[model samples]
Target: KLSPPLPLPPLPPKPIPKPRPLPPPSFLSAVHQGNNDWWRYLMAVGLIGSVFFVLTAALSTLALGLGWISLAPDGSVTIRDPLVSYLLSHLPFGFLGLGLWWAVVGLHHRPCRTLIRACGSLRWGRMAQGAAIWLALIISPLAVALLLNPGSLMPQVDWNQWLRLLGLAMVLTPMQIAVEELFFRGYLLQASGLLTQKPWILCLVNGILFMIVHLDNPETGYGLGWLALYYAGFGIFTTWITLRDQGLELALGMHAANNGFVILLVSYGDAVVETPALFSATSFDAAGVVLAFAVRALGFCALFFGIPGLRRDSVPPLQPQGSASEKPPGS
Candidate 1:
């Protein structure tokens, strides 16, 4: 009976699935991936900065020549229309973006996509998700405000003006937002990595520098200290997200959504980029602005990171090299 119960034929060998390839490391590796020469980095900066300044000066002159803007006798500038001025101001961003593209490819000798994401491609799905979530987070508060105090939002633009602003912003706002992300969080962040790999150190340095540049924004009139904190906080937030996600896709989407909402749906009296928004707020409570920013930052972090599926697949936090935060410059 035991002999008759001879063992059944051996089961067929199971197939082993091939492991998927990992995405290239965070953008922090970009500089190390290419020529990390200090001089080349400096030259790239000079090139883009020059392009921005020259375009700004030339545009201002042309605007004056065309009677679009005027210089007051007391060294003040008068804008013909806030919407026109805003659109014109965003023009330089386009040129600066091109210059940056050239510098990365020509000077750094790396694919320009290196500046976008390490895998050399934009994750459109990620960008869209980021935009949707960010837009929802911002619009929900305004929706509540509308429900509680409809009068708080005063109609500011007629149909025609609103349409014009929408068209221009649809084309230009994304460009402005993308260029800023490329320059600050993309180029500058990578350059800074050559010196130190500490995310906090990179965030602080970038945030301070970002705030310094934005000090010229009209919102500073609200309260220099509060606005400064707000800008620095935003800078820090964006940089942090960039570190977490390993690229600028999420940051780009969030920035575009924030700016688009401000420039299209609702605007404040002293917004830097004026828009023929559907509604306007004559005044903003400074303290409320800071508190709202804090709340929004926390909420964004929670929703972005708390959801298991939302996180980039198996991305690790960017860590300092050599077990220390600081390293010798160029090391």
Candidate 2:
């Protein structure tokens, strides 16, 4: 009986397995497999640059407003012309900030081949999308003005005003758009993605930051509630294009063209900003502005989502987790 019990016990011996090691942390994985550090440095430089650039812009604008800088009797800041004034006043310092940051990033890091390739592949489509957005913005304001006051479109224009307006459209608008894109799409979005490894979080944060920057605009009566809604909507649409298209090309093109066209078509009166746009005499109250924003929102949805290539799935899928070394398709 004892021997039989011993045999039964020997049959029940179990095997022991060695424990497996855990995977590396995500931050270490990013450093090892991805170029996250490069993006982080780039973002740091951009943040510093933005602060300086904004301070410069504010001081300059204040100087101009306070008559420290010379102005014409018409309350217009005088430089070479409206176009030159806008460029000199607004463009250079901001661009310098962006340029410096880019230079630093380029020097320290390997180029982001994926982003560059994405930009190249979708260039033409972006152009078309941008043109459509610009057209909508241009037509909407004019249509509203015309509907409200039929004779608003036929406003008289002097030659100097035309040159100033043209400059506004050609130079200042693009400059403003570039500054915004460089900060939001190029710097903030890129940095957030690299840091968090989550695209949607980046989109949300960037959109909110963007709207916050517009808080001081006099047009919204400093109303944070209305301004937040307006900017959030605009940011969501722009961010959608950035994510869906896998780059900022479409957003950049659309923003540049929108600013250019708006400056060209909408006149707010004796404003020294360069643009060939003549403003309607009729005042747009809160309701009219809200309506304009609604139209813009609807139009953005139609232009971006309605297009075949601009759909969410149409863009290249984001790189799979733990596969940062894998080159994106078509990259």
Best by lDDT: 1
Clash totals for all models, in order?
0, 5
How many collisions between residues are there in candidate 1? 0
Please report how far candidate 2 places residue 277 from its true position, in Å.
3.1
TM-score for all predictions?
Answer: 0.89, 0.65
Candidate 1 C-alpha lDDT tens digits along 199-288: 999999989988898888877776888778877877898899888888888888888887887788777776677667887775576556
- lDDT (tens digit, per residue) of candidate 2 on 213-245: 666554455244654666665676676666655
Question: Scored by CA lDDT, what does every candidate get?
Answer: 0.78, 0.54
Which candidate should be chosen as best, given TM-score against the real structure? 1
How close to the true structure is residue 87 of candidate 2, measured as C-alpha lDDT? 51
Q: Which 10-residue window in model 2 sums to the lowest lDDT?
A: 322-331
For model 1, the superposed segments whose C-alpha errors exceed 4 Å read 1-20, 321-331
